[model samples]
Target: MRLSLNQWTTRRWSVAEAVDGCVRHGLEAIGLWRQNVAEQGLAESVKLVRDAGLRVSSLCRGGFLTTSGKAFAEALDDNRRAIDEAAELEAACLVMVVGGLPGVQPGEPLTAGASRDLAGARERVAEALAELAPYAGERGVKLALEPLHPIYCPDRAVLSTLGQALDLALAHPEEQVGVVVDTFHVWWDPRVFDDIARAGRRIASYQVCDYLHPLPEDVLLGRGMMGDGVIDFKPITRAVLDAGYTGDVEVEIFNADIWAADPDEVVATMKARYEDVVLSRP
Candidate 1:
């Protein structure tokens, strides 16, 4: 399988700087974020990746199920724009972080003892995905649903597990919709192995990162380099390969500590760890 790195690992850097780091580490692919692309103009960013001989594996994110009416419409429009940007960059897929609770933004005040309407949020996600799928399909870009951990259920994403994400994708059954397997999100799941097998070829992309403690903001803190973490990545990697996934293994660490260091050093360290631990495993 080819190896890729996500710009999020070094979100502290500029888009150009991130691309340069990926190339410097000999990574074959890289995932770009919407914010990063916007900062450097799509044409220029695309050109930079091409010039460095790197493939755009996927775009970082798009999807918010919280708002309604004008808010929902605006979200859809932004996703379409993201799709267009992904097409311009020739990315393999547009990763979707399906949103959480309705009418509640992250860090917003919550009603006392108010339970989140998870089912409603999921239905909204499905509807939004259905609407966006055809558009993404028309652009020849796949939509990858990245199931955030349950820790993010209220604020970040409602799709909390691989099984749930696969269920959503199966419901759609369209070529445009698929699932992304991120180790950090799914490692603690009891059914992760089973879902990985189930995902099989429907796996749109794979992300590698480690978590030592509880969910924190996107940073590398508790995340030990691949093997340094508690996860059994070898079996997971083998399962993915056996299930017919030959896509790039994209390393995505959201650690503040790592970001504070030089971007190039972080890339190099991740590449070396991936090669020594995950890749070298039998």
Candidate 2:
């Protein structure tokens, strides 16, 4: 398995710097976030990775399908742009964090005004897949649906389990959409292994990060590097491998401490922890 550094792990680095750091560390792949790409200009970001011979395992995001009317239309247009950007970078997939209630934003607290009907929010996600899948396929890019933890259901992804993500993705052709098996989010579920097995070829990305105890004040920043928290990487990773996922196993941490460290050192820590933790299985 190849080790991929999801750009968010080195949150402070610019696109050029991240690409160079990947090469310097001999990492074969990197995951790009749209904000970073926009910061560097898509063409320049594409060239940087291409010149460095790095494979973009996946693009950070391309979904937020909870709005309606004008906002929903705008969201669709923005997602199309995200797909186009991913295509330009030759990314394997555009990771989709299908958004929460109609007006809630990611990582923010929900207000009384936000809709509380979870079922309706999920329906919007299904509608989004029907709308975006064909477009993503036309560009040879797959929509990699990611299930954020249940804590994020009010503000981030309404889809909150690997199984839920898989069911949502099954509506589209495997080439048009697939699921991301992020250990950080799914590790706590009892059916995780079964879902991982079921994912099989539909597993577009396998992001590795641990769930920390006493989750950070901002629950969004609670992901720890592989060996730093309670997760047992060996079993979860074995399940992913057994599912026939032959793709980059990305280290996608979100801890403030990690993001604050030197970028190169972060890469080095990722490599070591990856070997000692993730690869320790099978």
Candidate 3:
């Protein structure tokens, strides 16, 4: 298994620290985030990764096309900049977390009585994809649409299933638009195996993390380390490899606990967990 550590897995580490950690642990790949890359300076980030000989498995984000009017245009502009960053890093794909319900005001509760049209938000995402996919392709970057778990439907992302992501990706060329098979999001999908198989060559990236037990108040930070939660990785891992996805698998945990721990230990734990739970099936 080609294991890549997502920078978010050790959320506190800087991009330079993450690169050094990967090198220290003998990992050949690291997934990057745009914020840290920017803080480190794009040219420096490129050089750092090149010097460390670390391949960027995937770039953190590049979507959020659910707004309207000026916000919509701004969102598109941001995505273009994201594509440019991914190109500089030579990332495998830019993970796209298309925004959620349109009208929820900042700091406002997503559950407020207003009925949000999820379908409409998804339509907006499709429209944005049509506009951005060609641009990404021209830049030699692929947009990997990532579906968040349905629990985040109203607030974070409208794309809530691998099948739904695949549905949207069908309109574009496979090399330009693809679906991400993130275990934390797609593990509960009844058709995960089928959809992964269907995704086939269109599977741009495969992210692994556990869905924590006893949901935390901040569900967004509830991603657990593998084996510390209920996700059964064997089937999912096998299905992904069977589907012909020959890309680095990223461990993208968001747990506050893991982030607070020493990053080197986190990387070590990730390696052990991958060997134990993720790879040792049967």
- Give the C-alpha lDDT of model 1: 0.83
TM-score, cand. 3 vs. native: 0.96
In candidate 3, residue 96 scores what lDDT? 96
Model 2 per-residue lDDT tens digits across residues 47-76: 999999999999989998887788888989
Per-model tally of clashing residue pairs: 5, 0, 0
lDDT of 3: 0.91
TM-score (all chains, Cα) for each model: 0.93, 0.98, 0.96
Off by over 4 Å in 2: none
List lDDT for all candidates, in order: 0.83, 0.91, 0.91
After aligning candidate 3 to the native by TM-score, how far in Å is the CA of 122 from where it should be?
Answer: 0.9
- Give the true-structure RMSD of model 3: 1.6
lDDT of 3 by residue, 1-282 (tens): 699999999989889999999999999999999999989999999999999999999998988788878989999999999999999999999999998788764336755544478778888999999999999999999999999899877777888999999999999999899989999999999999999999999999999999988879888888999998889999999999889988999999988889889989999999999999887354
- TM-score-based ranking: 2, 3, 1
Q: Model 2, residue 16: what's the lDDT?
A: 93
The better candidate by lDDT, 1 or 2, is: 2
Tens-digit lDDT track of model 1 for 1-282: 888888888878787987877767777899899898999998999999899989999997888755578878899999999899989999989999988787666656676744477888888888898798889989988889999878678877889999998998886654788999988888889999999999988899998988765545543255655765678777778888888888888888867777788778788888787877676355
